[model samples]
Target: MPNDSPYKAALQKLFRTRLVARLDDLRQALKRQSRTTILHALRAVGYLTSYSHAGRYYTLERIPQFDPKGLWRYRQIGFSSRGTLRATLIHLVETSPAGQTHTELQDLLHLRVHDTLRLLVRARELQRKPFQDTYVYLSAKPKPASRQWAERQKLAPPPAPKERNLARVIDILVDLLHHPEDDARAVCQRLRAGGHPVTRAQIETIWAHYHLKKTPHVRSRHGRL
Candidate 1:
């Protein structure tokens, strides 16, 4: 916006609805209101009112917009970056009090362990427990579901499938499940070794179909499908 634009004037009016300030500090003080008021004013009046710098012309150069307001709300609602991961981490930690390990976060969050940890650390929503390598979500007060929810979560059903697989895949899974404590990846690798081709996702599919315990350390044990 121009330094003397009407939109800016409207925003200033909206912001100054209940404030008093001298001419010098007026701008800074108005900009420092509660986020709700500032956001409301921005949403109601802010737009990319273009201007120039150093005589280099620009259009819609850096006008404030409603989309970023949506983004900010989304972040608060757990929809992007730390919001997304923090949601998953919170669920995992609350559901599995053992606290999800690095590998589990990768699978559950569909993110690299380092990236998940970094975001969690940056947000300060999660903290690593002392004398241990595990992280737990921080809370000023205990939540209603902090521990009870975890107990109920233990009986939650398997994840639903995204796509259909061939019947041959089903047959192999049936054969594998017939064997107890069957190492899922090992079984997959054995199938690969025997030239029975399948994707890792497919193998995981087979395991899920039979309701196997698909833990990260499943590779360490061999048993039923």
Candidate 2:
């Protein structure tokens, strides 16, 4: 279709008013029976198909305000500058510094991507490895995947102690008797200051085992205990 086509003008006006429309809506606005004709009109006006809803929707290219991830959503329908969800996932995993976990990707994309991730892994388009209790997806490229894995290790929290250290537990209890108001973190800090190698996890373990609660100590104003 030419740039001066009436159907193109109609499509532009329809998109400007609705922001997003279905293929049927496009056909109706274009007054064209053929899907090819409608697509030509849409392309002539510069358009994007929704990445979500099985790609059932369309919008003008200029309508989307894509985020850092190159994604935008209209009334719960998603669109991506990267084109499809599969392509978007590959880009996100490849570009991420520490790679991404399934939960992380789901949180970012607001969609379940288990099957897609599985397929990507099988195809060797992305890689996955155990990280803590979850898997982290990385670039298929060896060097980038290695870098992402290393960075992920650097970012990970220290593993919790598998068993409570009896000496540390006693030290924490002793400190708690002196400073009854101190929470686990405060106890850890004071113990560390006192040359006791106690961690917050150990303190938490002790508290949990004994069901200890830290309550603020109060004193009478008239010098009464």
Candidate 3:
């Protein structure tokens, strides 16, 4: 194949045919006086790639082969997948069934989309709702977002049972006082085994009410965390 390197022989004449480089590497190779000045100059020449992780890695446009969706990455840095991060994010959220979270989006795209998502939300191009201690992204339209919220809630686990009665509450406290070292499940086992009506769920509530320290639970292989 014909040499497709952008700099071709020019790169060899300078940095030995290395077409892509970080700001410092390029500056050293070119014997440039200023890194900041050179970076801006490179951007003007259309050689800057998108920053990823914590705003570090950089490469040239040709170093990445952008997929149809306008995305690609090398090592830690990535290239823009399409138009703008904001646009790509909107496209993903629009087509998603369960929407997406900040971490989820980062994991999938290999780039941080938090700032773009914020901009999109403010512009009403997307919607966000609280779900399980975190916000889930959703469609901007009311109907789709509403449906997603409903589905998100429907899929959530049921709340723990409550011990509203005073006598039941006393029984729970008494058990805890007698078995100070017992974990929630252990207390429930003893209570139920002795014919009490209390459940592990109710025991958990008592734990929360008094700000009691919970025993460290060892998760079993069967997913018993």
Q: Give the top-scoring candidate (lDDT).
A: 2
Q: Write the per-residue lDDT of candidate 2 for residues 69-187, one digit (tens) a residue.
A: 89998899998898788899999999899999999988887888999999999999999999888899999999999999999999775444445566676788789899888777888
Say which candidate scores most in TM-score. Answer: 2
lDDT for each candidate structure: 0.45, 0.85, 0.67
Question: What's model 3's lDDT at 213?
Answer: 71
Q: Which pairs in model 2 have colliding backbones?
A: none
Regions of model 1 farther than 4 Å from truth: 1-142, 166-168, 177-182, 194-196, 199-205, 212-225
Residue 123 local lDDT, model 1 = 72
lDDT of 1 by residue, 1-225 (tens): 223344456556544553222222433544543544433434454322111111121112122222321111111121222223445455555445444556665554434556656676577655443213444343312563345334434535555554454555655666565654556666777777867776667776656766666444343357633
Q: Please, what's the RMSD in Å of model 3?
A: 9.3
Ranking by lDDT: 2, 3, 1
Candidate 3, residue 206: lDDT: 67
lDDT of 3 by residue, 1-225 (tens): 223243333334443355345656665654556766555555544564454544344555545677765677666556565535676687777666667788878886886677878888999999898888878999999988887777767666645335466677777789878877788888888888888887787788767666677656567889856
